[model samples]
Target: MKRLYRALLWLFPPGYRLAFGDEMTAVFEALARDRRRRGKAVYLEFLLTESITLIAGAVLEWIEKAAGREYPADVAAARRAETDVSVPAEIIEARQRVTTLVSLMTDAISRYDYKRARFYSLAEERERRRLRALETGQA
Candidate 1:
């Protein structure tokens, strides 16, 4: 059960998992142990409810992150500055373009639209090259 819970934790975004994985796991384990003392049925119900909630929460977190709303604007800006305070605007834009292209390509592939996927793949390659150039100060 602990292993399965750990696997579910992987569904969360990396930053979120890094920030709270151990604490969340510890709490879950303690709750599981307490629930088990009641009965198998009760423990199972708790597990089912928590598992579903975790999955839904992970999806919401990903959506929020993609929408650039995971953190409050001021905090988000501070985090970005801490990570890449010296990164130039052009480089950042280029990187974002590359990331967008990759996401589009993945969506196309998941929908089984090979042609659209190919187009996105080509665009992603071009964007990646642009990003590389910008990073190297050649653009």
Candidate 2:
């Protein structure tokens, strides 16, 4: 099942996959683990539902790409927020830094690299504080 899921993830655009493939794989594994505890029937149902969703999502992503859209809609929303004219550049940079840190932390956690994850967690906290300060005009 996991193999199939990973294969399906390859259907996404290369850049999108590079950014989100590991995270999505981690989430799928976690969900599968939890559902397995609920019994075979529930787990099988989850697999069917998730597989359908994955295929549909990949198709939509491809369509969006073909239409000249860059990034998923959710990611475009985040980029829009980041680019708000009212927001200071420093704040935007800090927010982006924090986001990157969080992604690194999650990737580390997914790989069971606790030490690396903890390092990223601490860095993310610092960036979060910097972002807050920038937002409040204190930095």
Candidate 3:
């Protein structure tokens, strides 16, 4: 079932999959794990529902991409927040630093390098705090 779920993820467009595939898979796995604890019938039901929804979502995403539609505001914000030109130079630099740390943390976790992941995680937290301070004119 897990294998099937992973395979279905390929229905999404390559760019969409690249941006969100791991997160979607991790969420589905966690939900599957939780549903499995409820019993076989419930788990099966969850699997069917999730699979159908995922396929539909993938199709819709592909259609949107093919049509060249704008991204939803939240997604656009997330993508744009890193490079928003209207923000101060210091804020943009801080955001870039945080983005780099987050990328490093993700890479470390993927490699099972927990020590480096932990270091990056801590750095991210500190940077986030600093960013908040900057936003509030406290830095």
Q: Which digits, one per residue and each the tens of the lDDT, describe model 3 over residues 19-62?
A: 67778888988998999999999998999899899899976775
Q: How would you encode candidate 1's per-residue C-alpha lDDT over 1-139 as one tens digit per residue?
A: 8889887875665456656678899999999999999999999899999999999998776666565665454345535643685888777676566656756766777689999989987987787678667866887
Alpha-carbon RMSD of each model: 9.0, 12.1, 11.8
Q: Against the true structure, candidate 3 has what lDDT?
A: 0.75
Candidate 1 TM-score over all chains jointly: 0.54
lDDT of 2 by residue, 1-139 (tens): 7888987875564445656788899999999999999999999999999989988987676556545576565566666666689877877787667657766766687689999989998997787777667776887
For each candidate, give its TM-score against the true structure.
0.54, 0.50, 0.49
Model 3 residue 90 lDDT score: 94
For residue 109, what is the lDDT in candidate 3?
75
Winner by TM-score between candidate 3 and candidate 1: 1
Top of the candidates by TM-score:
1
Clashes of 2: 0
Indicate the TM-score of model 2.
0.50
- C-alpha-based local distance difference test score of model 2: 0.76
Weakest ten-residue segment in model 2 by summed lDDT: 10-19
User: Of the candidates numbered 1 and 2, which has the greater TM-score value?
Assistant: 1
